[model samples]
Target: MDRPWGVPSPIRPGFAQAETAVPLMNIANILTMLRIALVPLFVVALFVGDGHETGWRICAAALFGLAAITDRFDGQLARKYGLVTDFGKLADPIADKALIGSAVIGLSVLGDLAWWITLVICGREIGVTLLRLAVVRRGVIPAGRGGKLKTLVQSLAIAVLLLPLSGGFAAAGMVSMYVAVALTVLTGLDYVGQAARVWFAGGPGRARGA
Candidate 1:
């Protein structure tokens, strides 16, 4: 099919599945699964001691950083060498949500992050995840730049907050989280709009019209 409105079709990544669907145990998918596996380790370290205790917090941050780094590596490897599989497509985002969602919820439990911030961010994450699944057969709703930026901001916020910092650094982390929240909401709306066009307006066929 032709490109979608001069942008590559959101489902373009799915094409990787067609070409490299089998041999699913490639490096990229392994990295993604490793990321998923690290979530519990992160949680254990996070809650092993009182919330702001230095040692546990550092362990948690290191585990979180490792997991986050795996996320990038998996995606890069997937794209860099035709390694995307259906499992990777499904597991990658689930891994991300498991990691970040657990962190946010753990922070709320530890009284670091506000319950409402947790609610808003987690709610959007869940809802958009469901939205992606709902529309998957229609077309891919690939992550836009804004969505990636939001993830980066959220990850930075979580990392900083996990570091047991104080004063201005803590303040900056809070600000980063709020910015992430705003971008999350905005991108959620953007996804809805993009989905409407892709699935409802005969997305693939209309590429020529544009």
Candidate 2:
């Protein structure tokens, strides 16, 4: 029989209780959804007025920044409130990739950023995502500090590049982008290593035995 929320299923004495179910809709999930919804609007703002009008560029950056802020809070809210759900797990990363990918790609298309940079970052993101899925059955790979830092750097770089800035400010944006790309590659390698460890440990089941 299916166990109801807060109802403990059969377990050996001294074992921890089964976790209660979290609702699919919650503040954290709503924030993630909002981030995803902003992507299209951000793209539109990016392309408006030949994609270079200072006003429209600011609008695009604001939209992107808002989306990134949501990314920051949603995870915290989920963990703090014990509101993590399967849907949130799936959608949160998708929303992040969509937002970042769109920003970089749109900037490249608009000639604001280089294509190689976009390709490198996007490739790494896609590769890491695939690695995560490949090892998901073994265990969930929580985001490490390095990964969080990389995301922060990437979002900041994208926001700077999205703005209609030039001179030293533009140079700084490029420099930050280089740093973001470096972190992307480094963290991707780290994730691959973590996945390998999880797979070798025979997943959670065998790890518990060990």
Best by TM-score: 2
Best by lDDT: 2
Error of 2 at 81 (Å): 1.0
Question: Candidate 2's C-alpha lDDT?
Answer: 0.81
Worst lDDT 10-window in candidate 1: 201-210
Model 1, range 106-165, lDDT digits (tens) per residue?
999999999999998888788877866766677655666787788888899999999989
- The TM-scores, one per candidate, come to 0.84, 0.85
lDDT tens digits, residue span 62-154, model 2: 999999999988887777666666677767877898899999999999888899999998897788778766776777677778888899999
CA RMSD, predictions in order: 7.9, 6.3
Scanning candidate 2 in windows of ten residues, the lowest lDDT window is: 201-210
The per-residue C-alpha lDDT of model 1 at residue 115 equals 96
Cα distance off (Å), candidate 1, residue 33: 0.4
Candidate 2 has a TM-score of 0.85
Off by over 4 Å in 2: 1-19, 202-210
